[model samples]
Target: MARPVTNAAFEALLKAAGYGNAHAAFARQLNHAGRGHGTWRYDAASVYWWLRGRRPAEHVQATMTDVIGRKLGRPVAAAELGFTIAQVPATISYPTSAGHAFGAAEQLWAMLAKQLTPASSETFQSDVALQAALAWRYDLPDETVSRSRRQPVTAGDIQSLYALADHFTNLDRRHGGGSPRARALMADFLVRQLAPMLHGTYTDAVGRELMRAAATLSGQFAFMSYDAGDHRIAQHHLTIALRLAKAADDRLYGAHLLANLATQAVYLGHAQEATRLAEAAIDGAGRVPAGVRARLYTTAASAYGRLGEGRACQSALAKAERALDRATPDAGPRWVNYFSPAHFAGTALKCLSDLHLYRRALRHAPDAITLAGQNARTRALHTALIATTHARAGDIDTACGWGRELARHVADVHSARVNHRVRELTAALTPHQAMPQVNELLLALAATPPPE
Candidate 1:
């Protein structure tokens, strides 16, 4: 008998569907989806056999794909899972027209509303992301955003949307982007309110402002999705936001969105792609406000840090500092207000820490904490950074002290990024578990429930 070939593509798709080695769970999902078909009692062993080259019935394959598609917030085909059939592309392209762009945004919003779990198997696609960035950089701006259908959109409508965006921004800053209440409210706002307005008639000037406001809200949701650990959804929203920015002819904001994408890429371990996106943002954003320029530099610094390019990272950081020095309090868009001295210091700390320069990273800890203002999520993250720095520097006692402080705030913030940092701190301290303080910190973290 011939040796059976493993279904590698199917295996990869299963993992990407958030079922990492959870064969039993995948089986259960299939069973649940196939409730009307028969009394299917698939288990881990069954999944094992399937992955090893045994093909399931056609109905079973359909059920499996359907389950995976829902979890991924997009469609999946049998061929994409390695079945012998006509191949279907399971990819989303960047929208090239306003009608398509709005449709894409609406589709994403609907999917987000239906998602039950935050887990996703969607990995960052550098080619797709870079292509979008390049398009934003070189695409011709839309000359007019005017529409001649539905009710006329007014400047008052734009102002109202901006005000709503501001409200959501404050909520995200204070409670973290993973806050369930904030996410729910923002989703409703986008779907019920913003979608209709986007379809309404408007003049060229109002249409431009409308697109800018829509881009702002979409970008906010993108950041929230990233913070919530939904990388694929975040990328989708960001692509839409970048397209909207282009439609509005706001190159600076488009650059900002690219920088945001770079930040996400670095977080998801795509450091090379991140570096390229960050560079694209800087090169394309001509004569932006000082704060925006500073932000772009810091974003590049982060990507370089992740790549271990110390000289390039430092150069970017230096440029960021200089640009930040020239930033006036009211110089840039309202969004740029978040890029203050404290924010710059925090970015520097992360960059230095990524290079294993723990002592240098610790130098910025105080400023990060004191100047973090009322942003609970930022404070928690900075605390985790400080704790991890100390632990990596062999200062277990001090690291434990900071870990204890972090434990106190763990229940308050709802950010996956903050939780990730806590996990990093725990990993750094795990080696010294023999010590009482380290043991206590670990126990506390183990007991800490994820934010609701």
Candidate 2:
């Protein structure tokens, strides 16, 4: 009864789609975004929260949607949500595993709509009702995976694998998450280099680490499929990522695997399942370091916010903050890297924003802006959020002025999310026709239709 969507049920849905996450082919889609590796890596934990439920500032939300849509095919609004409760199966995880989180796909889309520039009612993500947001992380491969490769994996193969992973990582990050060209390179590496390497002999530790890197990159490739709206293929990539996780024997990172699964669940509208996975991330995070733990809990709080459990959301938010506090500014894993105090504040402000705690959101806005000072994209994002809050509070002049500034600053950043947020702000200002500056801002937006 607690299960809003069954684990096996999603597997069946994925199976029916003619794609599974296990195939390495999905990684090939990353070329679609034409992004470099530097653009793909983010404050993964904060993005996790946004993926789960917290409503980030408008610009960030738009950028996220742009980035994801560039990878997935259809645009994903920041407001979209799909989470669960009682997520982890004691069968594979501990019996008492803390699973079960917040809302589902509806929340994700809603957050996205909130970030949109042209506000017609249809653009609102809140109107979207996600029914399959949560699903099982360990989706099965119906047919035989044909794991038998012709050659064996050797130490040299691992070096090559790391090099390939690093190469793509840099490429995707600089460009966007959906770098199909880079993804193809990885796919080739998988077929020729990795497949041969896996066959060669290596220690269990080496194999696990190698698989872990492969799994992570495969999931990154899944982003490309998702951008193309090829859920069939995207599902396949997610599956491969999970299997790689198991091969690696890193349960904590496996929890990260579940977190991604939870993201898909929310997109599918499986709130219950999404929540469950989020809770599992938190539970498994206990053994991780402070920064990593913060990442897990922050993601959990996002799920909690989606579930509409205000207290739970706040509690999780507090925990996330504490975890952030526990970490020295310099301490964090390179894989889930790029989180800082500023990043944490931006994330937490988003949680409050999702809860409609506008005052808190506004208060944190500047602090987030300050923290994001080093990041032009992020600073622009926070600036837009504060402007939106001002607009929401009926301060049109303040809103218009900030909106104009955002547009000006976005002049240099090539982020779709930034553009979307700036546009959405224009849409929101439409209601204030009487305000001259609002109209001016609108006219300016109308004149350009795209940032200079």
Candidate 3:
């Protein structure tokens, strides 16, 4: 009889145990586990679809479980490895203890690192969001106590982790999240490097800083996942990221995570939830720092615009602008350094564009492009937005001109949202689809693949 392979759960467990993309390693483990029985003959590629949520027979599940259990130095259950078709509990709520929060963060990291199919946005219960928000508002997690571990974590290790996160963020901004290699590279680092440190021994101070860094990177991962068109996966990461931020007592970063969650909510078409998250972000952030306050207000404006709440959107945008006026050097968390005058202008442009105030939005387009320095992806997105705004204004020539320019840079970054904007530009220009310029732009978009 042929050796049966179990399901995607097995693959996830294998990856979590560091067997991902290492066929030889997995083969060796499989051979060792099945040695007492008939030899199991298979190459790594044969199990590829197993990672895509397929399940194998019972014998296969048992064999794989043995291999994984032996490697993990404990007995493993088929259900634990994802062999069973049980519903995985959502870990979206805030935790009452630091340990619980960190554990949730670790599980979220594993799911992301393994690239598991995420729960659907429909599964995002509002009560979960409300519970998380209320918990964050009314209570803080207990302080992290010293943990017993094989290795003692140092401050230098924490700094290195922060530097690693910075490197990924820079790449994402310059190249785009759809880059062929960026997300996987970051995931590998999260699993192989940062995850270990989270389990290592650390002083309370070091642990706090480490959690903050982890939270920032997790949020970045969520955004990258979002840009790649994995909305549910992005939400899962953001929920866990917020928990980590809260556990660290990093109020500024927590607010930033909330804004990120709001942005995701807007993208998922949950306008009410988006507005709620954005408002909660602002209210929970007591004595907000200058840059972070602007970001939060800007996100609120975005949510409001999505809901066609022009008055509310403008009010939030005005507050964001006022917050910007009070900006000082590096006033917020280091992660929010990109929140600048240009960012404000770009966000305002989005709000106005959503509200059909194209002429007003167009006024800020030039500043957005000029000041979006070193961020090729942002430039591409803003350029596409400018093109769309022109299309909406009935200026086909200018729209197509910008669209043509955008086409040249489309292949440079890996962002689904950027591609979506270009597609929206195409739709906005549909009335003139018969035009040569319109046909040309359409062809350009056709050649662009969906983000991975």
- Candidate number of the best TM-score: 1
lDDT of 2: 0.51
Every candidate's lDDT = 0.82, 0.51, 0.74
Q: Provide the lowest-lDDT 10-residue window in model 1.
A: 83-92
- Of candidate 3, the 10-residue stretch with the lowest lDDT total is 37-46
lDDT of 2 by residue, 1-452 (tens): 22232334323322333323422222223212323322211222223333333343333334434544554467564444222321111111111110111121112222322221121121112111111112223333123212232233555656666676666655544443333444445554443334324333445556666666666666665554443233444444554565565556555666665665555555455555567777766665457878877777776766666566779878877887897778865465555665566666765675676677877766766567665243666666567766777787777777887888776666544444455566667667888967778778777766653322
Q: Given candidate 3, what's the lDDT at residue 439?
A: 86
Error of 2 at 84 (Å): 38
Candidates in order, TM-scores: namely: 0.79, 0.59, 0.78
Between prediction 2 and prediction 3, which has the larger lDDT? 3
In candidate 3, which residue pairs clash? 6-56, 178-414
> Against the true structure, what is every candidate's RMSD?
13.2, 15.4, 9.0
Model 1 lDDT per residue over 1-452, tens place:
54364888888888898886787788778867887864455666556656765455455677888999998999998777775431112475678976668767755654444332454564777888999998898888887889875346789988988999988888887778876567766765675567657766789999999999999999999888888787777788899999999999888889999999999999999999999999999999988889999999999999999999999999999999999999998888888888777777888999999999989888888877875556888889888888998999999999999999999887888898998999899899999999988898899988998777
Q: Clashes per prediction?
A: 1, 100, 2
Per-residue lDDT over 1-452 for candidate 3, one digit per residue giving the tens place of the 0 to 100 score: 44355465566777777786685577567756765644344335334435544344344557778877877788888778664342335555656676565555545544444454533443455567667777766784646656555457788988887888888888888777665367766765675467556766778888888788888888888888777776666766777777778768887788888888788778767888989989999998988778888889999999999888999999999999999899887776777778878788888898898899989888888777775567888888888889999999888999999988888777777787887888799889888989987988888877875444
Error of 1 at 55 (Å): 34
